[model samples]
Target: MPNSANLGHKKKVFDLFAQKVLVVVGKGGTGRTTVARVLAELGTKTGRRVAVIAGTSGTHFLAKEDPLLSFSSLEPGQVLISYLYEHGLGQLGKRLSSTGLASIISTAIPGIADLLVLAKIKQMERSDAADLIIFDAPASGHFLRLIATPKGLADIAAAGPLRKQSREVLEMLDDPTRLGVAFVTIAEETPVKESIETMKQLKKSSGIVPCALFINSVLPSIPGNEKVQDLSFLESTSPYYQAAKYMRTRSQSQKHYEAMAAKAFGLKPIEVPLVPTVELSEDDITYLADIVELQIRSKK
Candidate 1:
């Protein structure tokens, strides 16, 4: 049901290796997390030291205890949270004061020390190691604020170790070779519009362009032919014929909507089909990986 006019146009969604850091953004319930996980897996498959991190308080939900999961059958170092209060504070204290003095203060005021440590952890995560770091950032509206945190903290600290750390983060954010943002959305009106707006804001605020737009749950356009007509007719004999017809119609409508949304946003949309279930098994993930690999191969 996609616009027949836009059927064969190719989009680049998987050619992301050129980017050092990639942030995926989208409206809620648009499969942003799924896409982020896939990209992280792909990065790891290529033997890159990849780190996946959630950008908000919701990190606990996405990654419970072991924040990282291996996808390529190879076990790697665990992914650590970028906001560990105690450990971060310890590192900051070591940088700020002598080991003996910092240790004494840390013991005396553990609560305050932990709070300071947490901030430093976030700063280090934003600017440190790993060939590819994937950030499952907050939804579009709040993602911008998260990205702006370094600048905010920099201004607050002014002239201390915190300021220097924040500056490093800001520098990483501004470097094109160090960062890229991905916008994910469904083939729906509101999400698509929000994605466009998010892109505009991202460019204005960060001066970094999004490398791709992922159109999650895209309905493929099946050409009207004898086969489709036969399938359409076969539904007439069933009690649920009406439901079948509705599904077919809905699919077509969704396709057209996605096409228009992609055109309006001026982004080459990468289509990911809708699956029947919410919980994707390893086989399902493999199927998706194959699809993505095909898309990447086609681009080449």
Candidate 2:
């Protein structure tokens, strides 16, 4: 739970984590990973044990070089193998998925992999390791597949032990008090469109409305630039004029899409500024986290 004193009006933002899980979703390249990182840091700031679980492709955001042990990859292969170990297949678990046949078989199974994927997150929630878990979910399309696994499994294995397990996971997922979904997107067309589409499907299939929407990489307004229009006098061929003019036009365009995205999601989108760095450093991520910290307070 968020420490109210620490939040100091930031309660609503950070308090969402008290629910146990937040799965970050959006189209690829929309900075979902960055949003996850910011949220994780916020969790820690509010004095909760936070863990960032990323899909396979998102693992690199947490490097060995980084000292945070609170980050991990939600690889399905590892999930199945670990389940075996937990269920008394200890020795077999070690060598089972190591085999070529086992790898292909798990992949070939229709919903088995997705089952383990959700199961793994549920497993983390069930454990004592962390009180707050942030899943930097896979891309929108794949995330939809992952979210549907439990219900699909329930329909097929209605009476077996598999069905029982599915029921337990579904209970957690279906209960918004236990799990929350958040979308990460930019103020661009494709990502916002995909996000809205996914948001609709997510609500229809999972019965969970997103807890929040984060619009990443928004341009910060330069002084006197937000309203600037007639810059043709500086010489249209000049790179300086072109850059300023482009920024002005693009910034305005982003504001339009930002408003549309917020309206479509029916939630105010938290805007994160674009960083002027080649690669994000810890300082950069911290800066972003600080910016996002405002969202919590404002909403509170």
Candidate 3:
């Protein structure tokens, strides 16, 4: 029998995994892919089967590094084709794939491609393909459009298979137990501003709030009891002193943005330290994952 404490810990872990889909969203260059990969790594490391459905290209590289991870990218065109066949419209699917009709249809119906992708994700969830599925969604504007697709269609599509499918996807999006959004951003002016605004837009449009916020690439504070202002005293023409001064100033700026985000989101943002490397390796990802896991576990 599990002890009460152990049971509580398991419950916490289960709660995190219970949300079958985690959509990682942020501004472009805000490290959304890295955060998504970290979440995938955390799930697999915890012994849960995981899949990553990347909205952008080159993400399969993560899966290549981790044998336990499953990665796939959804091409809107292909997803539309597969969706038709799944509904017993095989001939139509083939015709569209071969001809320009697909483009015409996609262009004619706004959000059709995004809706189809959501449908595909919904299908994956129902099939239990993995214990957790991390969707590395497109950046701000695109992500807003993506999640809003189902609701948009449900309103316009009044009474048919289209309506039914749209409603179903909307249900998945609204169910907190089934879907979670992790918003990632760097502690810079534009990204921070965009992050808060996008999250508010997400809530207003979809009625789904983000489950977590991550401030990526945060610089560590300079050691010692010296105040931030005192760091200026060490300013010199030497490259080493210049580098130190730059880091201190940036670190101070990061703190200010982090606080601003925390206040707006009403949730303490998880700060991911900047890894001192040009290109992050698999081990760096794992190290970051461990930090996130530890923080989450501690919270529990």
Candidate 4:
């Protein structure tokens, strides 16, 4: 879609994460999870300790396999219900219940206590035990809310433990050395346009700019040759011929969109080809990894 050359000319965002944390975000179905998973695998391969966490349902696909990368899903413990049950009821239950009324209630509801403890364990597993945590976050619309939660909660709990927790999350967001966000998009009008808007909102709301823009499902340039011209001449031959022409035209349009987006963002777009099937096999992931390695090497 956009100009590959224009994207190629910009600085690589991976340079920013030489020894830091990175978070990938994008609209749904833009392959943000795949890119995040690949990055986690790459980090582990390079001898960096890596952990991948997902705040949405689709992220479970990444954890299904025995990852060369360490992985966890955050959805289980991210909700208000889960948070209250876990940290409030379970982990802090006995202590809070040390106050007679709380103790009597917690003791009475054994089922509630188990649920709370399980949730706390899950939350800690998602957030605390990672060297490089790759958060396969919720889609763009929900991501803004997710990032804003800390500040909102902090304002409400200015002098409590919740305030301290909020401060820690805020510090993670503000520390460039500790956290960075990546926005994945396709070389299409809707996704690219939304990605730009997401980046703007992220900066305005959280003071965090997306460090990278990944353009997925790029069509490689068709080689120039006499045969290609002959194929073009056959555009009116049949419906099949017309379909081929339409495909080429779409590719060209996508390239233009990608180039324009790159120029607007002042960042290089990481291009990933559109594979035919929806599900990617391990071999496919490995192939993609090779392409990523080349892109990174070229930057070096």
The models' CA-based lDDT, in order, is: 0.57, 0.71, 0.73, 0.62
**Candidate 4 or 3, higher lDDT:** 3
Candidate 3 runs further than 4 Å off? 1-15, 64-67, 84-99, 225-235
Comparing candidate 2 with candidate 4, which one achieves the higher TM-score? 2
Range of the 10 consecutive residues with the lowest summed lDDT in candidate 2: 1-10
Query: Model 3: how far is 53 from its true place, Å?
Result: 0.6
**Among all windows of ten consecutive residues in candidate 1, which has the lowest summed lDDT?**
72-81
The positional error of residue 72 in candidate 1, measured at the CA in angstroms, is: 17
Encode model 3's per-residue lDDT on 126-219: one tens digit a residue. 9968889888885537546768554566754565577777778889998989998888999888888988887888788778878888889877
TM-score of each: 0.68, 0.83, 0.84, 0.76
**What stretches of model 4 exceed 4 Å from their correct place?**
1-3, 8-12, 58-68, 76-79, 87-128, 146-153, 225-235, 238-240
lDDT of 4 by residue, 152-268 (tens): 535544654545555555666676676677778888888878777767776777777667777788766554421344665565667756655666787777877788777767777
lDDT of 2 by residue, 1-300 (tens): 111112122223435555898888877788888888888877777677788888764356833333333887876666665655666777665655444544664655555555667777888889988878888876736546657445675764465455766777788888877888888889888878877887887777767778888888888776666434566567777887777778878777777777777777777568888998988888887888887887666655
Ranking of models by TM-score: 3, 2, 4, 1
Q: Over all chains combined, what TM-score does candidate 2 have?
A: 0.83
Candidate 2: RMSD to truth: 5.5
Write down the RMSD of candidate 4 (Cα, Å): 7.0
Which of the two, 3 or 4, has more TM-score? 3
* Per-prediction backbone clash count: 3, 0, 0, 8
Reference-based TM-score, model 4 = 0.76
Q: How well is each residue in 22-51 modelled by candidate 1, as lDDT tens digits?
A: 767777788877887667666666777666
